[model samples]
Target: MQPTESKGLSSSIFISRCRAVWIHIGEMSCSSYKVKRISGFDPPPARVFAWRVLELKEQGVREDDAMAVADMEYRTQKKAKKKAYKELKEIARSEGKKPPPNPYPSAIKEIQAEEKKYVMDRLFNPKVIEIANKMKEERDKLRQDRAADGL
Candidate 1:
């Protein structure tokens, strides 16, 4: 573009106009380009399902109701259902006078054991350590090769 001396519009005004025109043309061109649709299909039905969480909020439903709805719709396993139910019941109990049901002993024990295993694996994972060592060795070899090449 040619540099303007004293033109019809000031330099900054001219630049802004150019930017606006460019953006308008770009947007028009992009709008003309066809975007692919994901699929001509509907979503699968879940046994339990909640409406979109945002829609619930917009409709001014209580937080507990929204979460419960979401969990019921989305959670597939019995364990997940139990967890969601327990949480909802607990919240309700806290708000009211009734005490929440005691969780089943077997389920509680299973949950505890699973949790313990998760913690142990996170803290001391032999496979992870082996992988880390191998990665460090590979990186060191690459560094050595680079140094030899004066890179």
Candidate 2:
């Protein structure tokens, strides 16, 4: 094989591999890609809520009514789960055994608790509120001073 022929043969092989990769990528369904993208980023609770609402809509429920119904159903299920866990804990206490671990521990609840604590400390605390008020007053006084100087 001459140098030129070998170069042509290698270039063809490279072009074919590139074409194969493009063809494989094109074979993937756009709808499936969109579904994967949505499901990947959306939280499970949000997906479940949307799914419930969709089911209600398919059953001829109005949009507003479907959302309300889905929210009510989700809250009811959460309350029932809490009550069942409480009952289980009480039974374990009465039997003098170690309480079973919570079967449905929620990261969302923990995050909310942390957020509440941060807000209470930084936003609602009397000292913090007083400091914020003082800063605002100083800013207002500075603005007034600047206006007077401009005048």
Candidate 3:
């Protein structure tokens, strides 16, 4: 083996040396690094617990009550949501009934209509029309000036 140098080597040299040692060990190991699958239809243990909490929720258990039983983090509450939604969809499918249309559709339509009305008002109202006409005249003058300047 080479003696350790007193001076530090460049990062690339250090990385290469570490990689060489790692590779040598990896070759002798039974297994190299293997990536485990993290997500699937098969629920993890945490998901199972979260699903139970969701069941309690469906049975009218309050959020505080469910959290007391589940001992999950705030983020893990999302898994309970996923579980609830999945069960809802499944029950709807199994019952041979079309799932109810999203209750917020009219609210969405109202919002879209409001946005369109606002845009139309901005584009065509008296004050807006006057401003738009002024801008058009300014643009025409600029275009004419540019043409005269051969620009």
Candidate 4:
């Protein structure tokens, strides 16, 4: 690894050196060695958690409360779907028509619904995702500005 000029990536990056200038900052490079020299957390997990907790607290709800609300909504939707399906069955019986497929495939769909709830809670319960999205947009804007300025 030839020296760009003075500083190069840290030891962590030099452990596995690839010979291609993937980037150019100053003498910019993709060498992980200089990763510490880079600013900002690549991705912050604890920050996300803290943001989520703060967001929920501001909204006057705990995580369990949010999960309960989700479950209740799920149940309400299930009940409504069941009612509609039953009503369709009544109409079919009176009209001597074949009943449509069970609109409420709860038995089969329950797992999927549960899985969706799990994912939503795990990934989106807190406002961390929203915060992350906004941060990404801001960072992208900053990069664009820097690029425009020939930085």
Candidate 5:
């Protein structure tokens, strides 16, 4: 049977095979197979956490203390959301209809899973901290260069 006609062949496996065939025929560049990096945009929860930590740091809080406060604030916000959803669920049940699905827990789990993939929790990952510092330095250097050029 032809590879493309094979039953239950996963898309990724099929694509890889096609790519290999194309490369052998000199029809595709190896450069096209390079993985693209994720963009610099932060997710909402991450942005909020970073802002809170930065605000605390600007107010003279130590790095560890700032991160702790930010972490607590994030947890508190999540807890409040879960509590609100529970209240809504109870109200729906009282009116004799099936309670609506509670989305907060699932959404939080998804966000946490995504964060885990990126090692985004700086408090737990020293590598993230180093990357953040390097990014900050690059930003600051760019600003200085722009100022010197009268831009």
Candidate 6:
């Protein structure tokens, strides 16, 4: 394991050449290294899901389709349960059993709903109405101030 002397080439060039290739006397260089293949691989669930969504998009699927696919099973189960409940209600009615009261909102909620609608109308209607109301209030205040000053 003696350091080789640089006879002709520059020191940097000799080192670079040695680093790039091994000089062997009628034998293969670096024979002690062996290559092996890896196996037994599995990806995480979130990565798999992201790849699946991207695949769907690449195949020209709508994003909504991919977004809704995750919740489709739950939605189908909910719909099936509602249908079963409706059928049971119909069967009970056929046996002359008194059905439950209508599930509509009560009078109190209806009154509150109307009040909410009025307030929302006043707040979020076209700017014309809001500007008119603001102008009317300012004019009334001005008139009151003038009356107080004159008195």
Candidate 6 lDDT at 116 equals 100
The TM-score of predicted model 1 comes to 0.25
**Candidate 2 residue runs with Cα over 4 Å from true position:** 1-43, 106-151
Clashing pairs in 1: 48-73, 49-73
Candidate 5: residue pairs that collide: none
Clashes in each model (backbone N, CA, C under 3 Å)? 2, 0, 0, 7, 0, 0
Prediction RMSDs, each to the true structure = 19.0, 15.6, 18.6, 26.6, 24.1, 23.2
- Model 6, 1-151: lDDT tens per residue? 2232443322111112111212221222222222222466554333334344434544566656753552454357557866776776788799999765443336698799779977887778897587878999999999999999999
Pairs clashing in candidate 2? none
Superposition TM-score, candidate 5 onto the true structure: 0.41
* Candidate 3 Cα misplacement greater than 4 A, ranges: 1-102, 106-110
Off by over 4 Å in 1: 1-123
> Please, what are the lDDT tens digits per residue for candidate 2 over residues 62-145?
768877887788789889999999999999999999999997788898789779987888877899989999999999999999
Cα lDDT for residue 102, candidate 5: 64
Reference-based TM-score of each model: 0.25, 0.44, 0.31, 0.33, 0.41, 0.25
Residue 145 C-alpha lDDT in model 3: 97
Q: Highest TM-score: which candidate?
A: 2
* Candidate 3: residue 45 Cα off by (Å): 24
With a 3 Å backbone cut-off (N, CA, C), the pairs that clash in candidate 3 are: none
Runs of candidate 5 with Cα error greater than 4 angstroms are 1-43, 105-151
Tens digits of per-residue lDDT for model 4 on 1-151?
3445546532111211221112122434333222132356442323333333334434667656644554455468668988999999999989999989884465558788778976786586667678778899999999999999995
